[model samples]
Target: MRIPKLASVFLLMACLVAYLTYVKWHIEGIKPALFKVPYQHSGTESDDDKQTSPDLSSDRFQYGIMFDAGSTGTRIHIFKFLLEENEPPKLSHETFKAIKPGLSAYADDPDKCREGIEELMEVAKGTVPESLWNSTPLVLKATAGLRLLPGEKATQLLDKVREVFEESPFLAKGDSVSIMDGTDEGISAWITVNFLIGELNDSDGATVGMLDLGGGSTQITFSPQDKTIQTSPIDYITSLQMFNRTHTLYSHSYLGLGLMSARLAILGGVEGQPLGGSQELVSPCLSPDFEDRWEHAEVVYTVKGQKAGEPVYESCYNKVEKVLYRKVKKAEEAKEMNFYASSYYYDRAVDIGAIDENIGGVIKVNDYSEAAKKVCNSIVETPQEHPFLCLDLTYISVLLQELGFPKDNVLKLARQINHVETSWALGATFHYIESLSRQQMTEHTGKEDKMAALSAQ
Candidate 1:
């Protein structure tokens, strides 16, 4: 307890040295270890990855809902997108559901359409996150089904849909629900295929064509070679600009040439004109032994085959020829371009074993013709469960031939690309985002210009 002064001073110096060392270690090592976040680097992160990676404070998933109201049914497409600040949005997931008897069925009783639209919106509600319900865009685009209806009746149904959209929590902007022009329908489909295949932004990419066969209309769209555009009819040529590239495409949507509509015409039943009660329409395309009632666009018809006569294929071809002859404009350019056919084309091919239902395959125009001939010839010996199979096959064959596709021309039949249904909805969603982005950019530029002028003053 009674230490010398020098010894006590040395003990104090030693204690002071220990304290400084601890402070230095804490500042240079322990504090940094406590506060710094360790990054596990697997590889270099891409610009896209960096942009789309979700911020801990903000969710980056965007949702869009689109309804396709065709002649046969109404379908809902709920798409989930991963959005980046300065990059094109990526489609991360999609939910698709459909209900029968299209919106056109409720044309006369417009009020009845609400239930169907509401049913679809419920699906959207379940698919998207509840927090994003107010920000998700909801849109409905009607095709030829409504286009063929009486203008007033179509308007009434559209107005009813609009009211339903307004009541929903999702964003419903002007033009949210409307009849899509046939040309727009074609272009949208074209966009879907091109975008899904990653060809939109490629300067040297070989873009594929699209063929969509709906109940009431068929669309063909593709970017033709420069010479093809030069020789094509001005009416068949459409200009599309995407990703800052201008594409002059051979795109057209033929009304009344769709499988169902063509069937009506081939059977000699006029659209919108019912043959009153009990009067039957006869066609050679059907099995002579077959007779049934077929319904379309809310109209029922007594349909049957003509009494046995010439060969089934010959007669059926003649009937189908009458339906398509000189009606659909042929795009000579399409013959050389590779095309992807979907909708009824895919369905019919699947029905006949021409393509796989899940993984579609390639088919030639001749394959359809041969299948048609076989189906027509066998109709008499063994009736098909679906009597219209013969007629449908024959019609598809003749339709392709008439459209300038040679018998040898190959078509890829696909119901989906990258697990997403091959249709116009995806394309429509992309277009909507592009439009919004452009508008925002324009506004931002205007604000910048204003600020600059104010600063100068």
Candidate 2:
């Protein structure tokens, strides 16, 4: 009794060491990012609606998590249903926090890459509301940056993320982290914008087309009916995809477009032989219509000071306009030369050639005023091919018919409803859930499996 056994003492010391190590690691893993209060900005359900009750059993969830891993950063958005019964969750109520430890951080080692994802997950989890801690679904998806990374790094990183976050009871258990395809990411981007514009419709009577132009690739989707794509509680339009036609909406990512466009427009057409340099003064065509173009350019403007003085002109274009003007002149020349050299490029130069041959080149010639009237009429009356896709909505409408959406109702919805570009995480999660439920059904014979049992009935 006076002395304990040496073996027992050794075992006790090992246990103490293990406990301390776990505590240290856990504390170190805590992320500092804070979650903003998830509050509804519009269309929130009213708590006082006594007739309506929160249907926790509904297969559809209003609250979930989306992780967007892009080239420059990782953003985790928490979408929560802040409304009470009888109220629909406002899509705008979603809140997010982003970390800049990009996918390139893991360019060398899978372990480091895994750490980046884990860090984001930790930060996201820590910031969400305590009430949603257990019920919120987490959808994880990576962008081209992550997916395009070669070697075992991408797969290993995914496995490690699954190992770390899958253990959390808060995450929907039994499902792995979602991995997105290029098409899914494109769809989500469109979805986000479409939802922002309040254009998602709930019906099978309409269809829509969506287009998403990303940094590396472009995504185009066509939905035929509103609910054919998924068995989601919401009445979402559905359609097949048109992977072959990337140009239906005329989106050309071309690897360097975003950066090159900015650089050329800002720096005067690269060095050595242009307007910014000597011996290059050819008096490029500076259009008098430049102001009109500027007004239409997509740019974020800034006001130097509130008026009291003459309007402080601080358009972002002002910084690069002159340089861009020269570049545009050069571009026109380049295009002409390129066209002159390549017969294929010049074939479609005229509108008559671009029109479908089936239409027999019915080029409707009209006077200026008549042309304006027709253009406006077409813009207003054209039927949508998909209702949910709003990005480049006009272009999407054309794509929808090409993608096999129904002609009348489908096109109308596509025109009227906004589109949400796809999310890799959400789509992957959905596919995974579908697969999982299928597996569970196959494995279970009893009534305890809720999803399977319901299906069986």
Candidate 3:
């Protein structure tokens, strides 16, 4: 049947709109064509992303939200731009808010999903920049905690989170909720950290290795050059597959190193070891109440000697902070302590009992010496590498020599990493501008344009 070209075009447009509406309401939260798909950029932006983006300069938003869901807590970094006359771009203004209700808190309670967003908002109270209050572009995201939700649960949780975002009062016109899984979380962290530390080698390079230590799980990503790993369970949009031509990246999420795991590991190991018979030689790090088990109350104890186990538990207001400082001060000794000994081996002083100045008497040190000694020995025999290492400009030069990478290639990699660092701050600004441009088009014409106008002032 002969049909007018206008009529046929109209029919096609109607079909397209119907499909889009169906996608938006019934299937996924948003259409892949209109929104960034989950895991789509798992390794890096796809060909379509590159093809669609035309303008990469001059954005409109002033503030950006960078959410980092760590092992013990979830941190939200709010950043704002400051315009200066003929000045180089920089992350001039920023703030951070964190919530301790980590992934474990929402493991069973689906309602707790919104807690992540709420916590960030509550903490930002008066701190939110005045400019961002009405039109700020909030980038909502998740990390290790929600990365591994089972099956459709992640989708439902993400949907619920989106629903909360729509209902949230803090949301601005262009605010968005992007739920991410382990791969994306780990990669983004790697990218963000290296960008901050000046490690990304180049604008077109690709590198991947991650060791992320989260609360319940550790995510390890090994994105080989020109290859992608299929570990992420979420659709492509939720994954953070980074693809660059000239950068170096490695990341991993180790689950057991968080505060909770570390404490448990220490406690369990200490339980098996027997204390020594020494009195007044107690370890200074342990508290007198080390042996007590109260489900809800704080444990208290005192260490007995100098360099000996002191009443560390009783002296500190919080056990975590005390342990953190102790850990850093003792980090050099980490290689000597095994996972088992890490629980109780503060020092040999703990083997000796503490002195009771009030009673003029010496206390006995119940030494778990043998067990601690065993664990310490293991640490020495097997050293743990840094969770992830950066192949910075200098590192790349050295690594290339060791691997016999052509001198030319070495120089190229070095140059790329240097360039990325130089442009790191601007890259983020460009990304934000691009996002704003797309949103404006969608709002006005119902046409989602991938290209965004971004420029530096």
Candidate 4:
């Protein structure tokens, strides 16, 4: 084959070019498929979430952002999670920031609420890595504060928040910004506390109960061993699934029973309805000599103490009783379960020095009684910033009794568990992320393609 050396060289060159092209195609196409065979993950997690989690061999990290729109404040919770095979997602880190005067405060001017929402978005952007922004679920669940607003005003406020969320880089759905049912709020908070306390890992173990008192409403949630526990009002019982197990919880949220709302009730003020001109709210809960204007949900009312020498504690207790009687269903099972109290429950306990600021302590139901009695009888000569302390403690005392806690029943109060804030935000975050995973499954499934083809016919 020593014909022309130039012809032989050309022949060799053509063969080499063909082999390189074949190699390129094999590496780009077939090699990927070798490693891409659908990997099966082991777990009892619903099939919808089976593929939502990243591979354990890789970075294996996820993030969730939740905004707790409560009556008193708007808080942003940025959470980082580490995914593991066949186990629950672990919360590795959390970033929390709160701004006062919730969205309802801007009911008259919804546009002004954008500034606070944007500021919180900045915090979220800074906390989460840029690459994960688009994948992270962003949600805002407004609680009792928004629920207390007029229908038109609530819609307007929610619309404003939705506009802001859509503009951000994070993942948000159509229902991202909305009012959360009070019972769901209690259930989410119950999930958070139980998960933080390591109770969710054991299916047979009794999960601790949750008591959350916010500015606009209060929630009580617990899981009783006996299935026959009757939750009067029928709607108070709810079933929630977490980590593949279903929990039957007796949870209720009293709309006007929240600390701030209760203060309004105890002072004889109506919710969402402003007091008319020159109308005054007088109560024995306040100091006999004190007079002031109190503002709640953007409405200001003239509030003051009752006349001097009227048994302050007794009168306050009777008034609180009126507000609570027949309003809250008594849960007899709370006496047997360990419970954790959060929100205003923690704040009031701290105010009275019943629990240390740094290390929260356990207190009996009567502790609130003792503190309320003392706060009511004495007058603080200084600038009484929280004149409602007496009313709050007393209402808590009566509320506990109405909820079936004996005077001597001890309850644990904490603002955080294991360095994580003991609020519904975390539990809600995990739940939201799982929902996103389910949505993704529905979107990417081969069945969708089949359905599209069938519809075309």
C-alpha local distance difference test of each model? 0.80, 0.37, 0.36, 0.79
| TM agreement with the true structure for every prediction | 0.81, 0.41, 0.39, 0.80
| lDDT for each residue of candidate 2 in 1-457, tens digit (9 for 90 to 100) | 5366887777776765675565545433221111122324312234532124444432224356667767677777655433323222333244456788766466666566666666666755665555666655666667656655664777676666677667664555544454466555544444433333433322222223443434434344433222333332232233321111111111112222222233323322332223332322111112111111111012222111111222111122233344323321111111111000001111111221323422212121112113222332232234423211111222222222232232232111111112222333333333333344344444442333454344445
Give candidates' CA RMSD values in order: 14.2, 19.0, 17.2, 11.4
Model 1 residue 266 CA deviation in Å? 1.2
Pick out the ten consecutive residues of candidate 4 with the lowest summed lDDT.
30-39
For residue 334, what is the lDDT in candidate 4?
85
Candidate 3 residues lying further than 4 Å off, grouped into runs, are 1-61, 67-72, 82-89, 103-116, 122-125, 147-160, 169-179, 199-210, 215-457
Task: Superpose all Cα atoms of candidate 4 onto the true structure and report the RMSD in Å to 1 decimal.
Answer: 11.4
Tens-place lDDT digits, model 1, residues 1-457:
5568889778776765675565444332211001011211212234554455455332466678999998779988887666444345556666778898898888879999999899988888877778988778889999877898899999999999999999999988897899998778888888888877778757799999988888888988888888878887898887765654677888888888888888999999988787877858899988887778888877788898988899998999988887787888777878888999988888899889988889999999899999998999989889697799899999998888888899999999877777666788888876765565455556655765665465446
Arrange candidates, best TM-score first: 1, 4, 2, 3
How many backbone collisions does model 2 have?
39
Quote the lDDT for 188 in model 3. 50
What total of clashing residue pairs does each candidate reach?
Answer: 0, 39, 90, 0
lDDT, candidate 4, 9-78, per-residue tens: 7877676567556544533321100122222221123344435544554335677889999877999888
Tell me how candidate 2 scores on lDDT.
0.37
Name the runs in model 4 displaced over 4 angstroms. 1-59, 71-73, 99-101, 227-231, 380-386, 438-457
TM-score, candidate number 2: 0.41
